[model samples]
Target chain A: MTTETKPGVREVQADDIAAKVAELCQTATHVLPEDVVAGLKRAEQTEKSPLGKQVLIEILENVDIAKREMIPLCQDTGTTVVMVDIGQDVHIVGGDLHEAINRGVSKGYTEGYLRASMVAHPFSSRVNTKDNTPAVVHTEIVPGDEFRITVVPKGGGCENMSRLQIMLPSRGKEGITEVVLRTIEESGGNPCPPLVVGVGVGGSSEYCMLLAKKAITRPVGQQSDDPETAEFERELLTKVNALGVGPQAVGGSNTAIAVNIETYPTHITSLPVAVNLQCHSARSKSATL
Target chain B: MPIVKKDGETRATPPFTDEDIAQLRAGDHVRFYGTIYTARDAAHRRMVQALQERKPLPMDIRGQIIYYVGPTPARPGRVIGSAGPTTSMRLDPFTPALLEQGLKVIIGKGGRGSVVKKALQDNKAVYLLAIGGAGALLSGTIKSMDVIAYEDLGTESIKKLEVEGFPAIVACDMYGGDLLLAGKEAYRDQPALGDYVSVPPAEKAG
Candidate 1:
C-alpha cells in the first residue's frame, strides 16, 4: 500500500529518544516517585510489628538520602524495561527504534552509575552486558502524534519472584487469587514487601505476563477502573495482607500497600494468570514527546 | 520499638566473639561498624569451588562477614553506587560450604532456605538484614571499599569494605532465632489497619 504523508505527524529524532530514555532510566532508579514514598509512609504508620515499622522508616530515610546524594535507591539498579507508545502518525527518524532504545539504556546505565545486571546468555556464557544495554522494550501504536515512553527499573530480587500460570477456566477467580497468594507466600520477605502486587488475568499466557509487568509500573495504590476487577483486587489484597507476610517479609499487618489487577479477553477455555510483585521501591517514570 | 542505635565499639565485625553475637537477637537493630566483605552469586560459586578443590580462597574466611551485594559503579568522588543487598536465597546452595570455612556473619535481604539456616546453626553464625531498598542511605555508612579479588566479575567481584555505623537488623541469630519468622509471628494475631477480612473460624469451633 502506498503511504500518504500526513499534514501534522511530527518527526522525532532517534537520538533525542536515546537521550530521554537514558535520563529516565537514571531518574527512575535514583528517585523514588512521590506516590511510592507516600505508600511506604502509610505502611510505616499502620505496621503493627515494631520491627516492620522500623524497616519502613529506614526505607523512607534511605529515599531521602538517595535523593539528596543523587544515589540510586537500591544497589541492584535493576534491569531496564522500556515501554513505548509510538504515535501511529509520527515517523521516527535517524535510526532503528529498538537500537536507539538500547543506546539510551547503555548511556543511562553507564552515566547514571547504575549496575550492569544483564547477562549475555541465559544458560551458557552469562557474561555481564557491561553498560546494562539491551533493554526489554514493549511498544504499542497509539492515536496521538506524541510519543510516550515509560522506564521501569525492576530489581532482580523482586523480579525473580514474579510467577505465571495457566489455569483452567473452571478454576476461575479462586484459582487466580490462590496463585497470587501462593506467589507472595513463597516470596516471603524476599521481594521486599509492603509490595505492590500487579496481577494479570485472562489473555494468553505470555500476554498475561506482560500485563502483569505493565500493571506493576502503575502508581502504587491505584486500582482497576472496572468495578468488579477493583473489588476482586481489594479482596485479594485483604487475603494477601492476612498472610501476615508484612514489610520486608519481616512480618506485620501491612504486607502490601496495593494490588493492581489488569484483565484482557482470553481463550474461552483458558485462564492465564500472572503475578508480578514490585518491592517497596516500585520505581518507574514516563515521558511524552 | 524504635531502632536501637548501635554505635562505636558495639558494632560486630571480624574477631567476632560469642559474646558479640550473643548480644544480638532476632529483631534487634544493629549499626555494623568495622569491616565486611562484599560477595554475591558468582563470588560465592567461586568460593565454593575453591573449597571443593582444596585450593586457597581469595581471603581468609575465618570469622568474616560477607555482604550479598553487587553494587553499581562508583561515580566521580563517590565510594560506590547504590550498594544494597541482593536476595540471599540465590546464595543458599553455596552458603553451607562457606559456613564450613568459618564464615561467621552474613548480611543480605530475604529469607534463607532451611539448609542455610541449619548451616548458620552448625557454624554459630548470624544473618542480618540491611534495609533492602535503602542503598542510598546505607551507602553513607560505607567509609571505603576496594576490590580484593575476582575483579573480572565486575560488580559481582569480592571486595573489602570498611563501613561505620552501617545499620542493619539481626534477621537470624546464632541460636536459630529467625527474625523474619519472629517478626511475622509478632503481629500474626493482629489485624493491620485497612485489613478488612476477619480470621476464619477455628477448626475446633462447633
Candidate 2:
C-alpha cells in the first residue's frame, strides 16, 4: 500500500493537553456535577429519617458552598485520574503525552489550591508526592481527530471500599446480586454514603475493575442502554437501599441513589466482577478538544 | 441557629469536661467553636510511632478533639482551603493509643471500628460526625489555621484549627451509645419512624 497523509488529520500540541487537563481537574474538584446536585436535592425531599434528611440537607448546602466559593467539595481532593480518548488521526506534538498530563495535574492542584493526596510508596515510606503528579491515566484511540479528557478525583475513603472478585460461572445473576448487596452492607457508612455503586461483569479481572471505575464517571442516574442491564441495576439499587445504610450510613432509605453496571465479553472459563463505590461527592468533569 | 457562648448549649466547643460529654447523646447536633487539631493517616502514623517511643506528642492532646482532615492549601485571603472531615476508620489502629493519651474527642465522618468504640468508652471520649463532602461549607466555619508538626508531610501535617459554628453530630458517645447503629436499627425496627416508605421482611429481621 502506498503511504499517503490523510487530509483531515490534525496536530494537537501537548501544551494544549496539559492546560485542558489542569482546568478539568480544577473544575471537577470545585464543582459537584449537575446530575449529582439534582440527585441530592431529590434525596433531601424523600429522605425518611429526620437525621438522614438533615444530613442530606447539609450535603446540599455543602455543594452550594463549594460552587459559590470555588473550593473543593471535600478536603481529600483525591487522586487525579484522567481518561483520555485520543483520535487515531490526531498527532500529539511538543512532548510525551503522560508527562504532559502529570504536569497538568501538578498545575491544577497547585493553582486551584486543592489538596495533594497521593503517596509515593505503598508498603514502605508512603511519602506524599507533593504536587499530586503521576496521575492514573486510561487512554483509548478512536476513529476521529478529536481528543477528549475526563478527570475524576477519587477520594481515598470510597476508593478503599472498591472490591474485585472472581466467581464460578454458576454464580450468575443471583450470585452477583448477593455479593453486591453484601459489599454495600459491609461497607456501611465508611465509604461516605449515600453511595453510587458501580459494578462491572465479565472481562478479565483488571478490565472488570476499569469498567467499574468508568461506570461512576457517567452521570448519577444514567443507566445502561441494554434493557437487561438496566433492569438488573434497578433491582440491585432497590436491594442496596433496603440495607438501611442511609445518608452517611446514619440510617434512612437512601443508602444508594444509583447502581450502574457495565459489562464486557469474557473468556468462558473466567467470571470476574468488580464493585467500585463513589461517595456522595461523586465529582468528575470532561472536555473535548 | 446562631451558637452563642453558653454553658449548657449542646453545640458548644471544647475544652469539654467529663460533664459536657456526659450530657451528650448519640444524635444531638453540636457546633464546635474554639480550637480543634487536624491530622489524617500520615500524621496519625507518626503520632502513634511517637507514642511507641514514649516521646511527647507534637501538641497537648488531653481533653481535645482531633479532626481527621488533610485540607487543600489556602488561597490568597483565605484562612484555609476546603476543610472537611475524612473517613475516621483509617485511623482506627492509632485511635486506642491516642485515647490512652487522654484525647477526649475524635471528629470525622462515618463509623468507627469496634476497637475504637471500646477505646472511646474506656477513655471517656466521644466520636462526632461532620458531614462528609461538605469541606467548602465547613471551611467557612474555620477562623484560623496553623501547622504544628510534620510540616514535610504537607496536607497530612499536624495543624490546629479555630472554628465557629463548626457543625457536627454525635456519632458515638462516651456512654457506648453509637448513633450510627441506633439510626440504622431505628429505621430497621420501625419503618414508620424512619423516612422510608417501606422495608422488606428480610432486612427488618436482620
Candidate 3:
C-alpha cells in the first residue's frame, strides 16, 4: 500500500470525540430541531381523535419543558446512541474511537439526568450501565472538517417493534407493501401511532438496518430523492393509513403521520427490506460542527 | 369507535370476588368500576418479592385488579397526569408469583403472554386490556392515586387508585379463552363475519 499523506489534514483526539458525544447527549435531549417541531405541530392538526389530539398537544408541551429544563422529555430517558459522520480529511488522535464515544456517553448521561438503559448481557443478569455509558456508536467517514453527530434515544416499546425481512424479488412492490402493512397492523397502536415509519430497502441484512435508522433524520415529511423509491414510500403510506389503526389503535383514522422509504440497488438474487417504527416521542437531536 | 366522556353513564363491572373470575369471558366489553392498583415492571417485581417473602404486601391485592401502568407524574392540584397501560409482556415473569398471593385481575394494553395466560387460568384470574397510548383520556377515568408505595422509583412505584368506569376490553379469560385472536379473526378485508368458539361466562362457571 502506498503511504501517501495528504498535507494539512487535521487529526482528531479521542477526548474531542468524548467531549463532543457528551455535549451532544445533553443538547439533543434538550432542543428538538425546528423542522421536527413544525412537523409535530402539523401532525397535531391532522390527528383526528379527541384523546389523540390531546396527547399530541402534551407532547409539544413536554418538548418545551425538556428544552427549558435541559432534562429528558420522558421518564424512560433512553439508551444512549451516537451516530457520527466524520470527514475523510481528518485523522483520529490520542485514543480509540469506541472508548471516546463511551466516555462521552458516560459524561453526558451523568450530567444530563438521562437514564442508563444499557445492559451488560442480553439474557442473564441484566444490569444497568448507571450513567448510560458505552453507547451504541456508529461512524461513517465521508467528504469535509464538519463532523455531524446525531444523538437519539429510543425507548424499548418502539425498539421492540422494529423488524427486518428478506423477500423474493418476484413479490415486488405488492408483497413488500403487504409485509409493511401487516407489521404496522400487528403493531397496532403500540408503537404510538402517528409514528414516523422508516423503511430500508434493497440491502443485505445489516445495511437494511442502517438505512432504516438513518432514514429517521431526514426532515419529518421529506421523501427519498429517488423517484421510484419515493413513489413506493407514497404507496406504503396510503395502505398503512387505510388500516385505521388510528392513534393508539383505539380506532379512528390516521395511524401513521407519514411513511418514509430509503432504498439502494442490490444484487439481482437478493432483496431485503427492514422497518423501524418510531413512536411520537421520537426523541432525537443533532449538531453539525 | 364511539367516544364516551368520563362521567357518561354506561354498563360497568363492579368490583367482584375471586369466585367472579369464572363469570367473565374474553372479548367482553368491560368498564371497570372500583379501586384498582397501578404497577408496571419494577413495582411488579417488588410486589412479587414481597409476596414471596411472606411479607405484608403494600396493599390488599385480594380480589383486586392491577393496571399495568407507569403514569407520568401528576402536576400540582391536577389529580393525575397522562396515565395509560404499558405492554403486558414485560410483567409476565412476575405474574404467577403475584397470582399465588391472590391477585385476581391484571389490566393493560397488550394481551398476556403464555405464562401470564397460564397463571390466569390456574389462579382463576382475568386480564383486561385498556386502550394503549390514550394516556390523557385514560387518566380522566382515575380520580387520584390514594396511596403510592416505593416513592423513590418515581412513576414505577406502586399506586392505589380509586377509579370509576375505566373502559377496557376483556383480552383473556380464565377458561383458556383469548380475545385478541378473535378480534383479528373477526376483522377482515371487507369487515369480518368470522366466528370462533368462546366459553361464555355461564358455561365457564358451570
User: Among these predicted structures, which one has the highest TM-score?
Assistant: 1
Estimate, for each residue in A207-256, the C-alpha lDDT of model 1 and write its tens digit.
Answer: 99999998887676566678688788788877888788788877788888
**DockQ, candidate no. 2:** 0.35
- Per-residue lDDT of model 2, residues A64-90, tens digit only: 888888878998888898999999999
* Model 2 stretches astray by more than 4 angstroms: A1-5, B1-9, B189-206
Return the candidate ranking by TM-score, descending. 1, 2, 3
Could you give candidate 3's per-residue lDDT for residues A20-66 as a string of tens digits?
78887767655665655665676567655444455466567656755
Model 1 TM-score is 0.93
Tell me the deviation in Å of residue A274 in model 1. 0.4
Candidate 2, residues B1-206, lDDT tens digits: the string is 22233453466667766766777778878888899999988899899999999999999998898999888899899999998888888889989999998888789988899999988888788999988888999999999999999998888889999998898888998889998888887665222111222112121000
Best-to-worst order by lDDT is 2, 1, 3
With a 3 Å backbone cut-off (N, CA, C), the pairs that clash in candidate 2 are: A48-B195, A49-B195, A193-A248, B11-B31
* Backbone clashes, each candidate: 1, 4, 0
